[model samples]
Target: MTRTVLAIDIGGTKIAAGLVDEAGTVLAEAVVPTPTGDAEQTWQAVADCARQVLGDTSVEAIGACCAGPVDIGAGTVSPINITCWREFPLRARLRELATGATVELAGDGVCMALGEHWLGAGQGSEFMLGMVVSTGVGGGLVLGGRPYPGRTGNAGHIGHVIVEDDGWPCTCGGRGCVETVASGPNMVRWARTQGWQAPDHADAAHLAAAANHGDKIALATFQRGGRAVGMAIAATAVVCDLELAVIGGGVSKAGDLLFDPVREALADHARLSYVDQLRIAPAALAKNAGMIGAAAMALRADI
Candidate 1:
């Protein structure tokens, strides 16, 4: 029988499980929403999904990724969005269903980079960055053709990169972070504060629609958001000599609504010779990047 691994992605909005082969193809998969409740309730929801996908398949190992500020050394995760789990023992708990297979954990940003490096938009790029722009902005690095988790496993966390000197305070306790302007919720919040007329429970999608119809405030909101994202990308590209950046997530679906400003900002800020070579592209794997990336991490014997 061919070797296979169990892959799981735990996000604030949803949880996904699948059986993946060594080549990054998903064999079996399942998905469930992240329920509203405490830690154990979320765990049970994930467990049920994993079992549904596992069924009668046997795997040699398991790979899991989550929204993070994760501690791989301690097998724990403390995602900003999932406040219920603060340093929760994730790898250890996953072991309960491991059936003796080894379990590995990683932050979602790192997984996105790994997956993109292996089979998505990052193919053939030796030095690159993978980013997810959603409720929050996330990023990871691929250096020398391998995933580089950095000293604390959050090396390429590009979202937290400070873009404004005295701008909005970030949830990460920083000031003027790229996330402050570009994240989905942040964009909506900013627009509302700027006199946008949002309906009840409006989200980024709703804001995009308003912009599509030529709402001046809505358009300005995305321009500001894109400017922040672009400036950050330009800084990262120069610092790391990155050749490409693969972007994915809910907010990324805004297409050129978000990217045009990003490109303009890049052209304005990245004037260095090496930085001029950087290319920005959309992610090809979509929501499946995290799962494939988790599997890629597990397949590595050298860690």
Candidate 2:
């Protein structure tokens, strides 16, 4: 066995693939913009990107992560943003692509947790939560030093945790979800409603820039988001007894602008002693987390 795996990270904005070794090093990688066209276009992009990394190389296993909610049993994924791929037969397609190799599948949130647990800020913690704060909010749990993907393979999904009773509508159908308050798009949407002076088509990065420049509304937006996320984290900690939370993804790049408030909110609602013990840290692996975590799944197929 080569001890290498083809790792794929499927997201709404991009599809990434990497050749990852057992030690978690990405020897080769490729990326492609997720197509806005039909499902076939998206699948072609994924296949091409994976092939770009693979070239002639063959691996014994393939580990794949997609934005959830995923049915790992059915090997199907229905990423909310990528509407074209509802119940897409991802694993079967991958299997067809690789004749002899085995394929492992997981939600991106699960992969994020697993990656952090394997070799990131979550190291040394047997029970932790890995959260990705980006265009969408999602999280996963590492319990007993292993990823705990529940029955539909989307356990520890903290985004759906309701923060406000009737604040904003979420893609998940529920209103006032933690994601409504904290996810990048929702944050920007909230900022817009508050009369934030923003450029046309401004995103979370733009909002972060305004916050860094001392824009009060923008700062307040981060605070609101952080508060929602922190409250959800505290809730999760109380329930799961998590030791730490490693947060990553695009919006987390805002640094202390986002983290300071998260810490403050975590403190505010940390009613229980065990919940107060939880720590929140930024992801150390940058953008490679999901792919690395997918590789981690391939490394320990039985887990």
Best by lDDT: 2
Q: Which residues of candidate 2, in runs, are more than 4 Å off? A: none
Per-prediction TM-score to the true structure, in the order listed = 0.96, 0.97
Distance from true position, residue 125, model 1, in Å?
0.6
Q: Per-prediction RMSD in angstroms?
A: 1.4, 1.2
- Predicted model with the maximum TM-score: 2
lDDT string for model 2 (39-158, tens) is 889999999999999988878899999998999999999998898999999999998666799999999998999898888999999999999999899999999988999999999999
Candidate 2: C-alpha lDDT:
0.91
User: 198-303, model 1: which lDDT tens digit per residue?
Assistant: 8879988998999999999999999999989999999999899999989999888989999899999999999999889789999999999999999998887743
Cα lDDT listed for each candidate: 0.91, 0.91
